[model samples]
Target: MFVLSVLLLIAAVVLFLVGRGKERSASGWKLGAALSAVAGLLAGLFACVHVVSAYEVGVPVAFGKVGSPLTSGVHFKSPFTDVTSFSTRPVDLNLNDDDVVEVRSSQGGVLYADVTIKWAVVPAKAVGLYRLAGSEEAVEERLVLPDSREIIRNVFAKHTSEEGYASAREQIGSEIADLVKERLAPRGIDVTFVNLRNVRPSKKLQEQIDKKIQQEQATERATEASRTATAEAERKRIEAEGVARANKIIERSLSDKVLYNQCLEAYKEAAKAHPVYAVPCGTDSNGTPVIVDGSKSG
Candidate 1:
């Protein structure tokens, strides 16, 4: 606008000087001044017409041919040309995952799921994406989100409820992220996060899963009890065998002659301490008795 105004002002001054030098009428000068003023006004209006914005770069085209995109500062272009503003900043897209749909599992169970994915267009490739995919909505509708849903369903379908909740959740999340990146990276959208927020199975399936878990736990308990009983029985059997072996050793160490000799020795020791009692020799109740007929010994 400034350049065009200056050009018009110079033209008016030139016209005035020439008309005055030739002694032309003042009306000619007025006419020339009016034309210059109008030209300047129109030029200024044309220059100020297009948009110059922040966080935006204009893709300028001249006569239907692709021109250089305007950088992050002030830019001026022809009034008749087209300039498309492309945002250079990151865009945050929140895609709600409620699709109002139910999918059946292989086990005759119906699974209902609500999940969200965070994604955005890579700002650098926005123009190329627009050219190829037409619009961000089009890109999402055609390419990015469908792939996301497919990846999510594929990952989720492989897991049981327990697996989906506990061990396989991280695996599913990682797989979804990988799958989305694989599909979206080529289309210039970066998938930052893919999360499985909520997954619900049919009520009947949930009950079945619960009952199955309960039965498994009961089986485990029964096996544990049987192991304990078997161990106790083995311990008692070992103890009984030990006692029987000890009794056999005691029996082997005893004899009738040894018992008789032990008794005789004890009786003799007692009789020597008490001599007044005449314990008969041959038919004595005591096994050892004092010998009163020692003089008749032949």
Candidate 2:
């Protein structure tokens, strides 16, 4: 740890105190003085040596003054400084974990969702970031969390509960990423991707939407049934009219002579089958005889 150098310095001070309280010529006094010198030297050397990992950059601070960012690998610095580490790689700030945010929609319906924002330290502006926020975690607390939460809430508020869970979900995430990027970019943080996932509306609102959908479906079924019944009734009416028209045509064409001829033909067919005779039963309007079966005449 970087603080190991500070501990060494304190030990050196302790050794120096022990030597001061002893007799100048004493062996114990000489031993304390030598140990004090060795401790001080070691402290200085350890403080100057900083080991930064591949994913991290170190910012050196000395006597309340901040210096330039030190990139990965071993760096030599002054003995009076402290180093703060920040990652150059992408960092995930998960709003779904401990940072869950609950938002109210435009229609005052409650919504909950999972959100993730990916960001990274801008290398060129690391010194400025270190000056503004003491550490990476401090940057999140002071900058990332507050801005992101507010942006998300504001964006979601522009949509209704139904839109929040469905239509406007993707748009909300995109607005968050853009706005957060605008705010953090000036302060050395690069916002990458924003993910919106698992958006859920409150139970009451969901039930309302479900009920409305069901009612619409029922109405559609009723309308289709009505149309089917009307079409069937019209088809039957049209068929009845056609049959009546055909019967009227046959009535208009028939005459008394045709009827008398039809009866005579029927009588002759009966006589051939049995010993039945044909007789004149009546006269038509044209003075034609109406044939009848003689055996059945009473």
**TM-score for each of the candidates:** 0.61, 0.74
Residue-wise C-alpha lDDT for candidate 1, range 234-258, written one tens digit per residue: 9999999999999999899878567
| Candidate number achieving the greatest lDDT relative to the actual structure | 2
Give the Cα lDDT of each candidate: 0.68, 0.81
Candidate 2: deviation at residue 265, Å? Answer: 7.6
Worst 10 residues of 2 by lDDT: 288-297
Error of 2 at 139 (Å): 1.6
How high is the lDDT of residue 121 in model 1? Answer: 62
Worst 10 residues of 1 by lDDT: 275-284
TM-score: model 1 vs. ground truth: 0.61
